[model samples]
Target: MRIPANRMPTAAAYRPDSRDAGIRRYFGLVQFALIVGVPASRLCSWRHGTHIWVPSPDIQVGDHPGWSMACIDAWVPGGDPFLRPPVVQFADTAAIRARYHGMPASTLWACIGDGTIPRPVVWVDNRPGWLL
Candidate 1:
């Protein structure tokens, strides 16, 4: 049975051990991609392989299906995905510069390159923003 994407649950609503836990508590492909920082198309292109871990949906939701947070968390390299908090807050270079007035951009870059500053959680567009 096809389920509408809108009717699918969000990641925040998922509870791993709840009685209502099932496909209904999972995230659809689009939502999963957003949470995992991968493109939806890349997720779609995955094929079952011995080395690759692919999450199976407990139930179908319309044309899209969902994967449990537990399953996705397991596939992630780190420890308990939900239990971990972001190590730092992210800010753009300009913000960093403003925070450290009088510091040269070159020095800032050098510090970042030499580990004086923490690296970014991820790059948005072409800008590198650090995680606090």
Candidate 2:
């Protein structure tokens, strides 16, 4: 049976299709920082620098800026993977080495030489790095 209009819940009582309560969901600075794999402190510094690390925010709520998904996708380059930073930044070389089964530089270089593995396709600070 259908309920009468007067007996039905109001629009305000229902969850919005696009928004969380009254506020629209957006990727804020914290979210942007995580996406680019950088410390929020570092992002903050970039935000004020001449070459801002992030594109202009899609929206600004009060004092904070927020980015939309489209904005981020367009800002982050899609071409030349070697030129971009790793999605998860490593603090030291040890962490990166762990990814390749703890293989040392010499062994990795040998593998590339013997055709056991592929050569590095990505460059970190002009030094070619391997990914498998």
User: How would you encode candidate 2's per-residue C-alpha lDDT over 1-132 as one tens digit per residue?
Assistant: 999978855423322246444433446676666665567787777767755545666444333455545554556422222223323221233434566689897886787689886654433222343333
Q: Write the per-residue lDDT of candidate 1 for residues 20-91, one digit (tens) a residue.
A: 432134456666665666666666565234343455553343233455465565655233324332223356
TM-score of each: 0.35, 0.37
Evaluate all candidate structures by whole-model CA lDDT and list the values in order: 0.54, 0.51
After superposition, the stretches of candidate 1 with alpha carbons farther than 4 Å from their true spots are 1-24, 47-52, 77-132
Residue runs of model 2 more than 4 Å from their true location after superposition = 1-23, 77-132
In model 1, state the lDDT of residue 132.
44
Worst 10 residues of 1 by lDDT: 77-86
